[model samples]
Target: MAAMKSTLSDAARQVAANALQNTLVDLLGLSLIGKQIHWNVVGSRFRSVHLQLDELVTEVREAADQVAERAATLGVPPDGCPATIASAIALPVPQADWVRDDEAIEIVTEALHIAATRLRKRIEATENSDPVTQDLLISVTAELEKQHWMFASGHAAHAQ
Candidate 1:
């Protein structure tokens, strides 16, 4: 089959492809982490954290889809395979089979913050190379930041 063509110049295409691929991996990893926490979280705050994890997983999955599609649109093959994500994901790993609700909050909050920070770098990398991809990264970063704030804030509320 003929390779798909992209409107972007070689350098620009490379930049956007790299950014999108990395972002996709992180998003997919975040979704997995959220689901893990949702299933294993315990304590009196379990119900609330579980529900929030579901919402976070939904948002992360949606963002991953968007990032992967954007890569395809740019004529880059998006690799979201488990192996790729496992190798590329920079997010924290769960230490145990079960986590306290507050601990889950801390873990997810830190993960989101880390993902958002990496996204900001991707946003900058794509700024001059491909503003369209940069825009998508910016939006994804915003949502991640929002989720991070929510998790952090909720944890604080519980502490008070």
Candidate 2:
């Protein structure tokens, strides 16, 4: 896509770009984590969790692309290198090599919570300087919230 000239001041553009970059990193991290859980989850609920995680991964991938492309459109180079993403993302890595369905839900839900919180902050950061970016973040945040609800709902019946 062609880079578009932004009406916001350079400083504002820089701020928005920074938020976008962070969002991209978080999305990438979440996607990888989801895939990892999808592959390693083994239990009675294995098939269901695996399929749900795959869907989450796909959603995260699309969100990451949207965030990165927005940064590029603003003329800011998005840093999507694996090292950069690993270092920049705030979500914790899962400690266990293999996880049961309950554990996987906890891990994935925590990551989604973190991502959703950060995305909301990014949306706020971009609101005044760039409504378009803020809107994009809002959409992303909404989707993340829905995914979190879905994941949480799966374990709700078992919760004491």
Top model number, lDDT = 1
Task: For candidate 1, write residues 100-120 as lDDT tens digits.
Answer: 998899999999999999999
Off by over 4 Å in 2: 1-5
Question: Each prediction's TM-score against the native?
Answer: 0.97, 0.94
Weakest 10 consecutive residues of candidate 1 by summed lDDT:
1-10
Q: What is the number of residue pairs that collide in model 1?
A: 0
Considering every candidate listed, which one attains the maximal TM-score? 1
How good is model 1 by TM-score? 0.97
Error of 1 at 22 (Å): 0.5
- Lowest summed lDDT across 10 adjacent residues in model 2 is found at 1-10
* Candidate 1 Cα deviation (angstroms), residue 18: 0.5
